[model samples]
Target: MPQPTPLPAAWPALPTELDGVAVTPADRARYPYLSSSYMRVGTPDLILMARDVDDAAAAVGYAAGLRAAVGQVPFSVRSGGHGISGASTNDGGVVLDLSALNRVEVLGADLVRVQAGAIWGDVAAELSGHGLVITSGNMGDTGVGGLATAGGIGYFVRAHGLTLDLIRRATIVTADGAVHVVDAEHEPDLFWALRGGGTQAGVVVDLDLEARRIGEDDVVVIHQASQQIVDDLPGYVHAWGDLMRGAPREFTSFLMLQRLPDGRHLSVARNVWADTDIAAAQPAVSDFARLAPLVQHDASLMPYSGIVPTPRSPKVGQQHIQMRDALVDVADRALGERVAEALRHDVASLVELRSLGGIVADLPAPATAFGHRHQEVLVSLWAQPRGIAAIDRAWEPVEAVASGVYSAYTSDTRARQAELAWPGETGRRLRAISERVDPALLFDAGLTLRASAE
Candidate 1:
């Protein structure tokens, strides 16, 4: 086994209050498991496993103190350690690990309180009994803090809005070690910034979310189908887009395409109907199946929790690929052509198209920091981590037609991506808020408003 690395000479001493929760590089067994994330490998000098809001505040205060003394220090706050950009972990930095703070509680008939460290799957399981569900990411392991604060585009995105839209209140620890429980009525600016501005505003410890009631059975219909694109890839893409554009608000679908070595594209689609009513689901599901010749197809009814089952596995950087995504108001033949071009250029190993625009568009753009409420589709690409220049070069076609970027889904943190993530007036407001709440940029991770300003 490799030996533990030493901390930087200038690294500040750990606060005595945090010693019980701190994990340094010296702990071989535990340190190795906590040092990395789902998407990238890291070797953080210290990992503070914050057990509560107080511990979270202390960690942030400690990092801020170090930055004040040394001018600059790498600091990151990690919830589930599943951020696609892998910004949650860093080499030779301080990681505020909130995994131990995971907790889910139902506050009322429709209100649920969840700790930042809790995974979406666990939240679903807890809320299942209540006959309520909150729209979160498709994956079970995604952290509540990261997705709820950024923007959650998932299986129910069309019926519900983004995860950020569900947040009624949040408990955040700002850079100055100040804990604030913010909502639309209290500290509204910070609350707005927290919803869609990534983590630049502060470290969110927990959130009070509004959950939507489902049927008595509390199940949704899932239709999964796959086909081999032997020819006319663009046509298939266009038809798929057209179908979704006309589909009912109850229908939401995600299509994944990957090029096989045999020079054919393998297309897989996951379609969901927010309700289990077969009368409303069958026609839309059939329309999607008719988009292409399917090699396999199946439909099932399952609890929302069934799809996002958590593995609770160790973080070892298992996903080794770079990802980029954009939100477009229209999914047309032109968009399909551009996606085909990107795939032909070997820019991505996998490309995904998720249908949006239902209740998601019901909210006005300026309602929260997560503008782009009018977008109709979310397109994402995944490729081997072959470096950013090459990926960006081949991604130009798709990016040209994009109206916005989802920062949480992309690994690119360049100024351009940041600008796309928060554009025009939205960018301006977010930058102002970040400067006020986190002037020292202690919680700077992923695509941020400060990066956009610069």
Candidate 2:
């Protein structure tokens, strides 16, 4: 993990060597791999390495003054930089780099304060030492700011609600550069919007989140398996979905239909038990194992931090990785066939399916800006796109039944419309809030939805 220093209380002088908060042209090359490898996109003309809350506010103020097109802002906010879409970075715009704002401190017995740029990996590692946990994304290297504002889906989804559910309050720098610590009792509307809302309103400095015990006593057993599917694929997929839906909330699973680096076609299932009680978890795990006998499995009894995946930084080179997502109910029979056929014809494409029925679906659709609570699964299709049209075609089958797309994962071209990322009444409400709060568009990081609009 990178060491982060605190900001000074009063104004210092120009780009000081102490905190190194300000990024001049000379600093760009050192921070090249801005985020973990998801895609090779975006190159900012100017990068403001914010050292603290004040620096982040100043960066947003400077960018807001750039004066760009009618709809788009001239700057983008980069927190974790794990966004699959290159929204954090831009072709020729400025980037409000929040990396140095990484601070995680336990405020009380049940609450912790985390800065926007803090990585989930570092957060989890720190919490494990304290015997505490917060539901963040499955990947450790994901940024706290990006997923918290967007919907944060994680390994503990079955036990805890979405990551945003744990957020008690947040400190944000709005377009006008004023700092506001918002919560349900504070700025109620912004608080509501911030929960699972897109990052279109402002730059979040740090968040105060509710914490839970995830000590060794709270051991979680995870089973992961993958193998070539030599049998009937459609029936297998439906059976897997059915088994997962009927299982206990403690048992959450993710399935990936992909082509290996070799020519083999495979479907992988990674299921988890959210409790320490092994006997109570065995039945659900057993039912899922029957869905695919060919897949080899692995199980573990470990703490919450143990489940965080290894480093998720991008690879050495910039590769063209194109991905799309859809929130859907149970897979239609035809869609399964389409996926199977697609898998056979194009081994290069992959489909990832994640279960969503635990606390995620239990929440009201209007509770947050995440529009897919009614959905049972999220199907993410990946391809090394030759072009946009081809990627669209491969994703069509799943999208036909899509409730909506997950804003954090999809490309700007795919999730551009307000309705696509946040559907129904949620879309209308989000835009109204965004328009009211930041009309000048200071924080319009892609897949934008504002709970403030006319």
Candidate 3:
């Protein structure tokens, strides 16, 4: 096993002035445990569990003071701790655990204020009682802060838009420890970064999101397509894109490849229809039903909240999975075949291509940090276990055909590959923003700017 890195000797002394705050080793252990996505294996130097926004501000103040002296600061705000790349953890640094700050306020029938620490499942369940559901992560275990900031893609994306698109306002604590409310009218630049830039700019404490009413009449269409149709999957995907171009705003669909319990590969199509009669929505999905024999088709009316699943605690020795994201104007049938061929060799490998038109493409590029506005499809490749060889083999074929990649889905080892993911001017702008916010080259775990030869 590799030895963990040691903390710097000049690291700032843990603040003892915090009221109602605990900084014991056991408390720090709890911080690492809050990470539902993955485990760091190594413990952090300290864990500050904040009860409110002021407590969070104090934590950031301590880190900022440490950076002033040490010339760098390594820390993260852990909310639901669902950062797939383990961006919320550092080998030797402070971790501000915001899970205790979970709170939700329903401002109106169409709006709500959610604390950063709240889980999406909990938020969805609360909102469902009022006949409201905001566009959130597909998995219920995702944190509000991480998902909202990192560009949320969920079942409702086709109908409503990404989670950030539904956000009306946000409260963030900056590098200087000042807490500010940001929206279209206030601190707009930081607000722009907060939407998609995620924790890169600051720790978002609260967010006000635009909610839509989705009742029990809403239908979640789920269908299973077999491996045999994998050759024809791209054509079906293109057809779905064409359908989206003409479909009503109430309908949205995405594709997924899952390894069944029996070790056989299965493709799933999840279609969400809001307010549209199932009879009316059936025609749009007719092309998918025609491509292959369906293993299971459960398209029925249900509450939007019913679709999200509760998250389990992080398991020990969980394999590190490498994920890659890309935007495509059209699904390349050749690339789909190549991915299918790769999966045949490695049963655990998978590829998911989702239609991305509807409301997603209508949003302007500068509307949020999520840059792939004009894309018609979103492609993602995943490989489990931490080995370099396995991940590289799984990604090679897909990378060959992908046009642009999503920065959030990438791995720490492939940080340099970000240049390839968000290429040219976009990559340069992200690097420049990283330099301005984290100039000392701290927070260099997953993706951070390093001095380049100019």
Strongest candidate by TM-score: 1
User: How many clashes in each candidate?
Assistant: 0, 19, 0
The digit string of per-residue lDDT tens for model 3 on 345-454 reads 46236777666677888887756666667766777777666576766666666667666666556663365455544455555666666567666544454544342211
Q: How far is candidate 2 from the true structure (C-alpha RMSD, Å)?
A: 5.4
lDDT of each: 0.85, 0.70, 0.67
Better of 1 and 2 by lDDT: 1
| Best lDDT among the predictions, by candidate number | 1
- Provide the lDDT at 251 for model 3: 69
Off by more than 4 A, model 3: 1-10, 27-32, 35-42, 70-73, 215-246, 258-265, 312-319, 344-348, 420-434, 441-443, 449-454
How far off is residue 395 in model 1, in Å? 1.1
Can you give the TM-score per candidate against the true fold?
0.95, 0.87, 0.86
After superposition of all CA atoms, the RMSD between model 1 and the true structure is 2.9
lDDT of 2 by residue, 87-151 (tens): 77776556788877899998978699999999998888777777678878678878898888888
Superposed model 1: Cα runs more than 4 Å off? 1-9, 217-220, 228-230, 261-263, 452-454
- Selected candidate, larger lDDT, 1 vs 3: 1
Model 1, position 247: C-alpha lDDT score: 86
Better of 1 and 3 by TM-score: 1
Count of backbone collisions within predicted model 2:
19
Residue-level lDDT of model 1, residues 1-454, one tens digit each, is 5333345688777767787888888888899899999998999888999989999999999898888888766788899999998999998889999999899999977899999999999988888777888889788999998998899998889988899999999999998999999999999999999999879889999999998888654545464545645366778777877888788888898888877776667788777888778887888888887777778878777677777768887889999889899898788778878887788766588789999988989998888888888888999999777877889876888999899999899988888888888889998998898888887777777778674334
